[model samples]
Target: MARQPLAPVRPPCRLYLITPPHIAHLDAFAAQLEQALDAGDVAALQIRLKPAEEGDIRNAVQRLLPIARAMGVAVLLNDRPDLARTLGCDGVHIGQEDAPLAEARRILGPDAMIGVTCHADRDLAWDAAEGGADYVAFGAFYPTATKETAHRPELELLSTWQETVEVPCVAIGGITVDNAAALARAGADFIAVSGGVWAHPDGPAVAVSRFAAVLAAVAEEI
Candidate 1:
């Protein structure tokens, strides 16, 4: 199927932060999150806690949502529309194996943002946009330990999606300050990072600031 072109994104890309799979100390992480937010322009924060009990997810959301919201960053829960709605999250990110987009919309309502993981498949991304997802995520663009997924999308895919869809696209998985500029120039509206920011040697704040610098540089060149 042929892809359709949409308006070009103004000022290029921004940062999207994802939580480390396990946030053992909510209070400490909350402080770290605040520092990162203060360091740069963060558009959203995804609370992605894996293999955790429902209560733990809820607790993390309860502690972190306010901080994100206060910073004017959207808060998205990973894979739990029910909890997302119940806890008043700004949105939810649903993977292919997770709940369907329709169900998530029904749970989150029209105003809430919902993003879907489309991996490296343009068809999936097209379907997701057609299905009313606020954004479609394509990724593992580089090697990543954050999660295991076989699909590794190329930088060109971002250009294709940008030229085709009005709905914004996110490039995630193993993205970091070092390699993020390529994705931005390729037309990703947002670059989602997990360990790239959270586990940076200089710390999350430095990571975010560096990413912001990269995005700014790319925006100018593109």
Candidate 2:
């Protein structure tokens, strides 16, 4: 399918932070999250608690949602629109294997930000955008320990999507301060990071600050 052409200028790519699969200490993690958000421009935060019980997920959301929201970062719950709606999350991020996009939107209502994981598939991205998804994510651009990745998208995917689509695209999976600039230049509207930020040696604050610098530089060049 042919995509709509976008304007010559694009917005500066922003950061999207994802929580570690398991946040053992909600209070400590909340403080760390605040420090990261305070250090740079973060567009959204996805509460992605893997292999956790419903109670744990709820507790994490209850503790962390306010901090991200207070900083004006949209809070999205990963893979569970029903939970997200009940928990009052800003939105939900759904993977291909999760609930269908239309169903997710129906559950979250019209105003919710619903992002679909396209996983290097152009057809999936097109289907997602056409179905009214707020954004489409493409990646495992690099190897990541955060999760098991099955697709590795080429940089050209970002370039092509940026040039053709207007719905906003997120470059996720394995993005870091060192490699994010290439993705930014390739035309990702947001760079999603997990281990890249939370596990940084200097701490999440320094990681976010460095990512901001990289994105800013890329924005200037393109």
Candidate 3:
């Protein structure tokens, strides 16, 4: 089947934030999220609450989505298209094991931004893009404890994808400020970060500021 070309991403590259695998306090995290968004430009936020009950996920999304949306950040829910649509999130990010892309699109409609995890396989990424994914995520470009994945895509993958694909590509997994510039230069449309920001010694705001600085510097050089 012929694939529909993805809409081009503006500004070329940006930060994509993911929540900690677990959030014990929604209010505290909401404050931190606001600070991070305030400190720099973030394109989107993924409410990734693994192992949490549906009610807990709903609560977190209700509290955090408004903060992100108010700052013009898109909110994405991980692994649950049904809840994402039901709870009014901007989109859902589906893993290889999650709902099929067609199903997710059916549930959320064409307007919803649906992203698919392609791991290290260009073939997988092509499949997702051809299947109508809004963006295709490739990772772990660096080692990560955020989630366990066997595939480790190299920096060159982003470069290659950028050269060939119209769909935006996201570089994820253990991406930190010190190393993010390389990905930005390599042509990642978005850098998906979680522990790298939340676990930074200086704090999320400082981490976001540093990442923004790196990306801005890279943008100038490009």
> lDDT scores for all predictions?
0.94, 0.95, 0.94
Cα lDDT tens digits for candidate 3, 124-218: 99999999999999999988999887989988999999989889999998899989999998989999999999999999999999999999888
Error of 3 at 44 (Å): 0.1
Best by TM-score: 2
Of candidates 2 and 1, the better by lDDT: 2
Highest lDDT model number: 2
**Which parts of model 2 have CA positions greater than 4 angstroms off?**
1-7
Better of 2 and 3 by lDDT: 2
Expressed as tens digits, the lDDT of each residue in 98-150 for candidate 2 is 99999999999999999999999999999999999999999999999999999
Model 1 agreement with the true structure over 118-213: per-residue lDDT tens digits: 999999999999999999999889888989889998899999888767899999989888899889989999999999999999999999999999
| Order by TM-score, highest first | 2, 1, 3
Candidate 3 segments exceeding 4 Å error: 1-10
Name the TM-score of candidate 2.
0.96
Determine which window of 10 residues in candidate 2 has minimal summed lDDT: 2-11
